[model samples]
Target: MSTDSPTDGAGAAASVQRLFRNTVVAVSGALSRRDGRVSLSVSGLAYFLLYLAGLRHLGFGPSGYEVSVVSNPLVRAFRQVGPFQWEPIALVVVGPVELLVAPLNMLLGAVLAALVGLNLAVSIVAWRGPSACRLGPGAGAMSGLPGLLSGFACCGPTILLVVGIQASAGLLSLFQWLLPLTVVALLGTLLWVGSRVETAQQVA
Candidate 1:
């Protein structure tokens, strides 16, 4: 009976130690996640608000008058840039309510939200076990890509707003509208890809 008593006491002590260790780990993880969640929300909301404001200023129309094929002989010479030649193509002036910018803006917003969520996850894992996060500098950079992508999405509309407003005054007549078109196209493509990443996460 004496020996059995010692064995039972030792087992209870071991179990208590394990329970304490687990409790500490869980609390640490939760705190880290909470910190990351706040960061993500601040950054994401800033981008969403900025984009909405910029879109409001980019009143509808081809931005500047659409360049026609006849008006832009350079397009024929530059076949690759032909799609950008706004002139001659039938124009559809969109109303404020008909703005098509929402799709891409919302897409980027979604990616930003995911980025915040992933950051929180990583933080929690790191808190639970430092080795579990396994993210080096490269991984950190990769993780930040979604936020950068969101920046680009917002910048696209900003560029349009600037060029469209500038050209309206004939100040940038010499500067081709191709600049805005190409920038918009590139950023739009990136936002689309980022949206796909965000969508996949929802499915998972």
Candidate 2:
């Protein structure tokens, strides 16, 4: 058994509370302006579409309109075939585009997209604001890394075709963690950016 005491637990809880409060402050502050709102909407939508494209759920095909749903979609939606990936239970085709409707995957992608958007918006707003609040290019890079890494993960074996790299067990194993790592990085960077924003507010 672990030896952590009540005081340690309380301290950790307080720390988490502070972090969340600061993050909320940062987010609310960013979204209060037109630029931040635009950033969130555009970036979020773009990232979500890119994420679906990475999953190969949205793509071009013969021109037609059709919607197909699998039997027992509710049950199938929970089925997992890869790390952070779920089975698609429907097919939607309209014109030259097609989409595999996977409820779980869509949910996950939405979450990742939202995080990426918020990260970019907060970082961009902070960087463009007063001198004390400038977060710089590092924030942009951090915000982008998750989308790229997770996109590669979503591509699965197909990514090898794009990168021209031979597949191996080691490489495949690494892919399993990419989405999770991306999530962690997104959250961590969000908190870090918020902390900077909070500090800047304090300084000013």
lDDT of each: 0.41, 0.70
- Decoy 2 TM-score against native: 0.75
lDDT by residue (28-69, candidate 2, tens digit) is 877876778898888778778777776678788999999999
Return the TM-score for each candidate structure: 0.30, 0.75
Native-to-model Cα distance after best TM-score fit, residue 87 in candidate 1, in Å: 25
lDDT of 1 by residue, 50-130 (tens): 444444512444343332233444443333322222222122234422232234344544554444333334333443443
Report clash pairs, candidate 2: none
Worst 10 residues of 1 by lDDT: 81-90
Q: What is the lDDT of residue 57 in candidate 2?
A: 84
Q: Candidate 1's C-alpha lDDT?
A: 0.41
* Error of model 2, residue 69, in angstroms: 0.8
